[model samples]
Target: MDFARTATWATAIKNLNPDNDLSVPLSDFLRRGQHFAEFCAFSLRESSLCDFLGEACKCAAAACNAPMAKVLQLGKSANRLTVIAQWGMGHDVVGSDAGLAEEGNPPGQALVEGTPVVVPDLSEWPDARVPELLRRFDVTTSINLPLIGRSGPFGILEVDYPQAYQVGPVEISFLAAVASVAAEGIELMSQREALTVQRDLKEVLLREQQHRIRNNFQSIANLLSINAVKTKDDAARRGFQSVERRVFALASMYDHLLGLHEQRDEVDLSRYLGSLCDDLQQFYALKEQGISLHCNRRLGMTVDLNTCTTVGTVVNELVANAIEHAFPDGVGRIEVALTSNREGSVEICVGDNGRGTRVEQCNGTGLQTARQLVTHVGGTLTLQSDPGKGALWTISLPSKGHSAA
Candidate 1:
């Protein structure tokens, strides 16, 4: 593991001279290549920054036949380098700081020059702080390789040899390649950390906005309810109640939207429609009138928020219309069923077992509004009615993005 002897042989092999022996240098070159490959694999497997740096130092030390190696990262001010990772002969120097501007600081000099600084014989150096510092660990030679990033040099890879050693071009080339790979890995890890922070902040802000919107909708509905109770005219009271119900419907949509954290653009159709029906039944006091409202979902499906809202409004209007005019004796059953077909379309059928009316003669504003909404979203509405068998309204919508045709 004598770096100087092996480096001389490696240099001879690089010249491609046929007189010199190449067996030993070629074997050493292959061994160094294998170590470089192992370092790259280790870098990819590690996720934590600290662990990656520590293992990188170990790999560098082993590859260069050096007894010790450490990584020094530049601080925010760009004037100081802090020891972040060490492989061997380290007496707890991980948090130690070295001033970059300090005279004879090898790492600082390497980073400032944007290249490698080789100290062939630290023992013969005169009045230098870095050489004096290395004397404590019995080091006579060292090399500092700058870790260059996108902006510029950001850190240093320092390898310390126990003897006076001259690093040849082949060894320096191998170490420089390792430094490049390590710097790129560090940069990628930093970017991923930043993106994760931004995503978490965005979710917090979105949740706060959802809460405020839900509260505002509830307040509006409550005001409408209070005005309906105070109004003396029967028609005016009914109008207020109808407006209040529509406002509450919008509020319910927001509630569902808030619950869907992962799929914000889509809603659970079965759960949303089922909740809307329950709210309408309670609002109309259907149970006291011997009326039961039932929602039957034949299959689970999800649709975008816009389509779900439109479908909910149409169902609300149709159901309310049945409650008001279908059951004259105040005793009947209403059923809402959701189904999808092989044609990539969804169907909602609202049927009641009360008195029926002719489809051609029906001309209520609610029914008209429902039909218009359905048509606006590239969907269709149909009504089937008889004298005594009850009435059935069917709405068909595209399962995916529905827009005006």
Candidate 2:
């Protein structure tokens, strides 16, 4: 069977009416059509080819009122058909193979001729192609329908009865419809398996690439650290260390990437920010200067890698600036807090209880860089300060990567 034949059968099934002059009852046509619809509706619930085939065999059997049914597929060599699914049959009968050359094998004949074969009375028929196992079970009547796929006939659907049942055109048409569904299911299952394999391979390659990039970033940071230690000038040493920390901040993005199997471009904003703050505290020796740094706890929120990197860089520069310029006596407190609202907007505040200076009074490039970084990612940065009070730098980010007013 091919798509054309399948479409013709579907048309016949759809045009079914009680007034038509048909040998079979109208109820049989309606019932069989219902079975086809039900099978199609629930097919997605099947997780594997074997499971789908099993349900298909059961549906075929129930649709035809047969006691036993089985499905056979042409082997890779195309010389034999192997039993892949069965209903109301012993487990031992599954996985059995039937040669295409067998004189009376109905399934083999169906596959070879690309048509259905009906043995209404196997006992009276000459050289009937019934399997030996069916003979042991006293199967007297059987019908084999070719399961057609996109390429052509690929398998057979066989239904057997214990009594010498009279097979009719209605039964044959219904079984053919069932066979079409089974063929389509088998093809879909094969495609799904192939896609899963491809996705697994891609994931492996991505992980390897991320790992190599992370290592390279670490190497660059290490070289910068070494140079920072060997430098005699305090300003040059500080510059080297600052560049090294920025490199490390970028590298940390890949650390999150390596652990993710899906959503590779998104990072856990809460966790990443917390980790960055801890690293900054240790690197700047905040505890030794009695300048305690604290980051408030936040619920997990995810942001894209680009946005995350930009926010991290801004935070790094602002924190470093606060440590260097805000606390003149090296004795003050700094707090970092992240908050999100129902509108999906995010706000980050880095505040310090130290002698404050207005934004225009600052001379370093750190504050300028931080403001530019925030604006580049469609966010806003503002500062609140008084001469003897503290400085509070607040960053506002809109949802969906939009700019805040």
Highest lDDT among the candidates is held by which one? 1
lDDT of 2 by residue, 1-405 (tens): 446347424532443333456666788767777877887776767567777777778888888888888888787665678888888886777888654624467777766655677787778765555566567768888887777666655677789999988776667767767776777777777777989999999989987888788889989999999999999999999999888877876766456534453265666777777887888787778899889999984657777778877778888777877888887888999899988777978888889998998878865676677778888888999989998899998888878852222
Clashing pairs in 1: none
Clashes of 1: 0
- Global lDDT scores for all candidate models: 0.76, 0.75
The TM-score values for the models, in the order shown, are 0.76, 0.81
**For candidate 1, lDDT tens digit of each residue in 1-405?**
223223322332333323244233777888888888888898778468767877778877888898898888888775788888888956487877754634477777776655577888876665455633466677778877777665555587788988977677666767766676667777777778989899889978877888888889989998999999999999999999889877877776567656444255666788778888888788789999889999998545877777888888889888888888899999999999988878878899999998998976778777788888989888999999899889999999975743212
Q: Can you tell me which runs of candidate 2 are displaced by over 4 Å? A: 1-22, 44-47, 90-104, 121-132, 151-153, 257-268, 278-291, 297-305, 324-332, 340-345, 355-358, 361-363, 386-389, 399-405
Alpha-carbon deviation at 234 in model 2, angstroms: 3.4
**Per-residue error at 389 for model 1, in Å?**
3.8
